[model samples]
Target: MTTFTIGDVTITKITELEATGDTELMLPDATPQAVRQVTWLHPHYATEDGLLKTSIHAFAVVTPTRRIIVDTGLGNHKMGRPVPAWNGMTGTFLQDLTDAGFPPDGIDTVLCTHLHVDHAGWDTRLVHGQWVPTFPNARHVFARTEFEHAEAAPGHGTAELFADSVTPLVQAGLVDLVPANEQVTPEIQMVPTPGHTPGHVSILIESRGERALITGDFIHHPVQLARPSWTSAGDHDPGRAATTRRVVLEELARTRTLLIGTHFPGPTAGYVIPDGDDTYRLQSLA
Candidate 1:
């Protein structure tokens, strides 16, 4: 379900989407309305507001020595979600991972860009109604600050989501709560790109002069390449998220860094390119 290799790193996109009904998730002003314009939505997706869709993707980063997973998508057995699509259900993300040749036990590290439902879903799995780490041997890495905040606001309806997907990993001794800016490896560095979450970090990979930035929910669609200020309603801090998006896009556009959006449609892997006069577009790799 995921794409692979911008340079040397191998990426696998895992999906748990039940449908592809809503097509307009990209907006025109997004690059310039996000999800409203750049998105290739069908006629049905058009509405008074904008496009909307729900296909969750999780990325696995396979290196020479380490098998790392970035952002575990929506998992099974989660409760209290608004949508019936993502609440208390079973899916095939793990099966798809194995089909992609990465079994659950093979993952050495679980890197959560942030602790949202879609981003942190597969950290654990259901075993006779118990939440267990999907990757039994892997260390679940999360931002200490994010975990704290989510923990503090337990009854605010977000508590159960984090409790099932995150807290159990910590209690089982598989969690590695690191500082916001901790560098997991030479090829991998966690840049503290807060706003989405207080400790949200984007994973950067540089090898043989080739660099790829796994943009974990920083900007959802290609539209953000142009209008970096259009924060999604889901962003924890819209203003800060917009600011981070602008800064990240500016640098990526300037440096021509390769990128992979965790939620981008079709070929999720691509690069942010200057379209014209300060505008930008996403060029996907085949």
Candidate 2:
């Protein structure tokens, strides 16, 4: 279990699963030769052969006032995943959460960065042939634009995701639709960082004087931090994703804020250090 704290709030990384994906697939513009040039990526983010290492994990943010879960990872017993491996996945995610000291009923809020298949899977669980909210007592919060955009959005990619993981929460009156920049709590706020999805946002956590940003797929891998232009395969809008990535990086590098990538591989939290005029490297906090 990896954990970090900013002032009074404590954030822990509870991993649901870890796996390696094709580097070229993760960054379409990245060639094997190109990736090797970025020496900083090896040993953690990528393999010697350029396979991109990644993890599906959730951040449990425990504030003095609220126990919030940011981005539930790909859940168990889910189906209709475009990728066969993610479909019908079974893991000890809840047990892992409990092991980390946050119980299901103890979670006060579920913050979804976006409704992508992997990010929002644990919002609900299947029981007795029915879908139900996993966190019986927590309020599942989603960006209003993101919640509405899923309805008219093309493709059935997120259709099963909505029916199984999201709609059930709404049916249970556990879903709250807020603006993209909604202030979740006194120390936690959502930053409108679109491009991965229309209403995609990152969690900006501040308390006392310390700050950290939970990047929800706005930037998937650390490689993008260096190139700042190599887009993810799952990006809804690669061009806009790249643009937003650069802007986000500037702020992260400028202030050296702690960055936690939702899908980043080993040691997910880090600081963006300026390596050159246009290059930034992830200096892991581990």
Candidate 3:
């Protein structure tokens, strides 16, 4: 239940899953030797054997005005998911959230950065054999453009995801489809950082001069922070995703702002500082 406070806003990392494996599998472009050479990533981001530590988690953003669950991790009992391990699986995501002090009903907002399988899975839960919204009292927010794009151009895992995790919320009439860059509250707003998906966006939290950006899927791993041009294979548009990463990373480094990457493992929340003119490093706040 580690939490970082920005002004009055408290952001907690509630993990759904944690793993350590190949960095090259995720980054592809960055081989073991290349990644190992980064030096700063060792003992935390990478193991002695060269495995990369990764976490699939959500940021429970507790603002003065609202309790927002950002990016629900891969849900349970889901089927037809593209990833073999994610298919028909179950996890303790909700119970973990409750244990962290934010119960399902207590959450006032569910902010999804995008409609990807992992980020949107827990948007709903299995209820009496039916998929339903887990947070009964929350305004489940999504960007209209992202939703529409996911619906019309569903890809691997996207169809099943829309059918189970997303559509159910829409049917429940709890969905708030706002403009891609709309602000949810005084302290919370969306940043349009597409390329991960057609309308994928990142969440920005600001309060009392302090700031942090929840990097949805814009940049998957810390290596990408150093090698901004290295895009994920899953990226909808690798080129655009790389572009977004470069711009966002530079701003984060220049401003010395806190970065909470959705899929970042080990020490998740950190600051991006300039390593050289063209690259940067992740300094974990944990």
Candidate 4:
């Protein structure tokens, strides 16, 4: 139930799952030897044995005029997923969100950074053998390029994801395809940080002179802050992803904006501090 206040805007973490080790599946280059080199990662982002820690969670963002849920995590009873553990997940994600004061019906917007399996799984739920939109009253938002790419050639397990989670929303007329840089609200704007996906976007929240950035997949682990060149194995364009990471880290570090990592472990919010000429580290806000 971690929460952060950026002026009048409030962002709450609604955790669905957390795990350690098995990072190589997402980051092929994040070997034990390589992860151990970043000393600051110990105890939170990584273990002493060099296993990376990560979480699957959604953020409940509350502004003066809107209640938004950013990135619904892997859903329950999802079949044919590449990862066995991710399939048929029975976690209390919706209950957790409700307990945190953001119920599905109460959410006015469902903002997906990208339409990946893990990020958009909970967009729909299985109801009487049919997939249906979970947030019945909220508008499911997606980047136009992302929606088109996933529709045409959904990669790996994404074909099933689109059919069960994404397509249902579109069929229900609850989807809103917008540009990558669409302004969600006056205080919440989408920051185009592509490469992880063709239309990947990070969220930017600014209000009353305070600011924060919710990093989607462009920067997976805190280790990327130290080694900006290390890209996720799932990245659509590794080189471009690395470039986006490096550029974003520099700007965030310079402005000292609070960085909220979408997959970052507990104590996920932080300040991107410049560690070296071209390297940075997250100074945990927790």
TM-score for each prediction?
Answer: 0.87, 0.97, 0.97, 0.98
Tens digits of per-residue lDDT for model 1 on 115-169? Answer: 7777777888889979888898998888789778767755434577777887788
Q: What are the per-residue Cα lDDT tens digits for candidate 3 across 1-286? A: 7788898899999998888874454678777767777788788787765566788999999988899999988899998887777877777788888999989899989998889898988888888999989887988888999989999988978999999998888888899989999989899999899998988999998999999999999988887767788878788898999889888998988887899888887778899988887799998986
Candidate 2: regions farther than 4 A off: 154-156
lDDT of every predicted structure (CA atoms):
0.73, 0.87, 0.86, 0.91
Query: Which has the greatest lDDT?
Result: 4
Model 2 — TM-score against the truth?
0.97
Q: How many residue pairs clash in each candidate?
A: 18, 0, 0, 0
Please identify model 4 stretches exceeding 4 Å from their true place. Answer: none
Clashing pairs in 4: none
Candidate 1, superposed: residue stretches over 4 Å from native:
18-54, 154-157, 276-278
Best by TM-score: 4
Q: What's model 1's TM-score?
A: 0.87
lDDT of 4 at 203: 94
**Which candidate order results from sorting by lDDT in descending order?**
4, 2, 3, 1
- The digit string of per-residue lDDT tens for model 4 on 53-93 reads 99999999999999999999999999888878999998999
- By summed lDDT, which 10 consecutive residues of candidate 4 come out lowest? 149-158
